[model samples]
Target: MVRASACGRPFVREGAVSAFPFDAVIFDMDGVIVDTEYYYLGETAAFAKELGLNLTQEELNGQVGTSHQFFLRMLVDWFERAGKGHLTGEEALIRWDEWAHKRPRDYQALINPGAVDTIRELPRRGVRVALASSSPMDSIEEVLNACGLSDAFEYVVSGEQFKESKPEPDIYLHALDLLGLPANRCCCVEDSVPGITAGKRAGLTVIAKREERFGFSQDAADKIIDQLPELLTLS
Candidate 1:
């Protein structure tokens, strides 16, 4: 349970994962479970376009892994900057959610390859599984339900449940508390810099799902894997 360097030392090799050292595995939802990070940006850009605003990829990149509250505030600011009529963050969120729901993204279709199998197989291998996502509760439920994983996790937590999310470590710390396991006894699976930083700050071993499209750096994690099922090969 020693902290590895930013070099991201491998916790395991191409061997059986049943010998996995952690007591529990906490997952981040967006890019870890589903490739929604990309789609979310698309939705955001589309919504912004409807408001006569065009957001660059660089601007949308900053929104990755951030809490919904932070995203709403950013959206409000963007709207005001675009002369789209000044609106409160809450109002912007409501409008955004309304627009998003109208489009109705197919969560099942967006699920990352091997993600569902990885989540479902973990508990059978004697590893407890939980979800800690920055998405709101309703959105979390939607994804879980659509992915047919409503009962898959021992616990499911949302960033909206806390005063702050990711990079702040509050969400991860609360998740560890709820799991009743010390950080050393558990690990976090994440993809974004904020999520990895949160796990590290919470004192858990962070395994990042390597992401290249968003210009994210996975160097802060203890390990990096190309796919979710790679967890099954850990030691």
Candidate 2:
């Protein structure tokens, strides 16, 4: 593997074609990379506690693996409709960031284990790599940079760039267009239900990271995995 400074993208040393089942592997960021699902749980809970409201696992689940704009819209709408607060999306996000800073450590520091290794290993094995995350590009860059994996993929697609987020397949489809690979030629690793549905809708084999967040149906995925290392073993 040789590192090229071409925008920090990793280039595979000229190598033989691999016998992997899929020509490309599309990954969903957030929960899969930065453990942000867990982070969101804590932060949202903190926000709820600050307002004297109980945070339910189910409520938090709906916000998992969503775009920054999606999250902002969801939170702001809820608050407005509930007559709780009149904060704008930007203001809410600022409060969240402030809440994050007040903590002992930055949330970005808590990374999902084996994420980087799996990402690096994919390109090495002759599989094109892409990130089809529902996160906004800014959040994606921030997290990946912290993980030191910003340049590890051939493509990093954000949901905001597409017409819709996960569950609509637009994001994954856009990634396919960027990768120049057909849906059958690609596989997606996703940790959320909407993400899995989106990948499946795009006609790609969707692998689920075993998690119960978001009330996701276990049957939605083509396969379920317990850890990131499991991807390396997939053909």
Clashes of each: 0, 1
Best by lDDT: 1
Model 2 spans > 4 angstroms off: 1-13, 16-18, 81-88, 104-109, 213-215
**Candidate 2: residue pairs that collide:** 21-235
What local lDDT does model 1 show for residue 10? 26
Residue pairs whose backbone atoms clash in candidate 1: none
Q: Ten consecutive residues with minimal summed lDDT in candidate 2?
A: 1-10
lDDT by residue (1-235, candidate 2, tens digit) is: 1111123344455453456788888888877776778777677777766766666777777776666667777667656655678889888777667767777545457777788888878777777887877877776777777788866777777777665688888888877776667898889998887888888999999998888656767588899998888887776
Q: Kindly list the per-residue Cα lDDT of model 1 for residues 129-187, writing each as its tens digit.
A: 87889888888888888998887777778898778888889888887777778999999
